[model samples]
Target: MVGEELVGLTPEMIEASQAGMKAIGAAIAVGSTGLASAAAEMAIGSAAVGATAENKDVFGLVLLLTVIPETIVIFGLVVALLLIF
Candidate 1:
């Protein structure tokens, strides 16, 4: 995008530029949330694993807790899709 002209641009070119910005926004949305989810899961999942190892009966609860972080990624994907289309 270096050396790109800003002046004397046609309507179609301007529209295309806006569309590209939207795509970048969508990518940021999904990527940031995905990273957040990963970080949350890193701590929660490790703890869950240890908890489950200590008591077999706690496996179900830990499993549920481990999976809850993933919901943020789903929401991010939805937002990204909405931005793109």
Candidate 2:
């Protein structure tokens, strides 16, 4: 969108894109494992609570935390889409 050129990306843009991809990869690795552990903890807690686990307060918190990992992937996809376009 520069000067009505609608030009494609430059070398610097490509490099920045590569760097962003690397960062996203790192984030996914760290985030996914964290989410998995948190979910496991939630499962354990639920098992402990057993019959009294009808209340969703703890479940909701764990669900939100688990979603953080997926959000990183979503953000990575958005960046990839931007690069493609």
Candidate 3:
């Protein structure tokens, strides 16, 4: 069996590996979300600039809308933390 092949590895080692893998997964989750947030922000920011140029009164609203994509990164961090802990 696979277990027999890994006889030299202690349970602690196996556990450590599992933990490392989970940490990697967590990092990946956060990293991916951060990338997505950046991309979304770029698109939103360009549009916001154009919109703001057209209407000074809407600048604040446009700014708020542009930051909405940041929530995705926040959520990703939360999920990553959950995965790690």
Q: Which candidate is the best by TM-score?
A: 3
Residue-wise C-alpha lDDT for candidate 2, range 8-68, written one tens digit per residue: 7787997887888877766666566556656665665556465337665667665555455
Q: Order candidates by TM-score, high to low.
A: 3, 1, 2
Please report, as a residue range, the 10-residue window in candidate 1 with the lowest summed lDDT: 1-10
Deviation in angstroms for 52 in model 1?
1.0
> How big is the positional error of residue 61 in model 3, measured in Å on the Cα after superposition?
0.5
Query: What's each prediction's TM-score?
Result: 0.85, 0.39, 0.87
Tell me which residue pairs clash in candidate 3: none
lDDT of 1 at 36: 95
Write down the lDDT of every candidate, Cα atoms only.
0.92, 0.61, 0.95
Better of 1 and 2 by TM-score: 1
Q: Could you list the CA RMSD of all candidates, in the order they appear?
A: 3.5, 9.6, 1.4
Model 3: worst 10 consecutive residues (lDDT sum): 2-11
lDDT of 2: 0.61
Candidate scoring better on lDDT of 1 and 2: 1
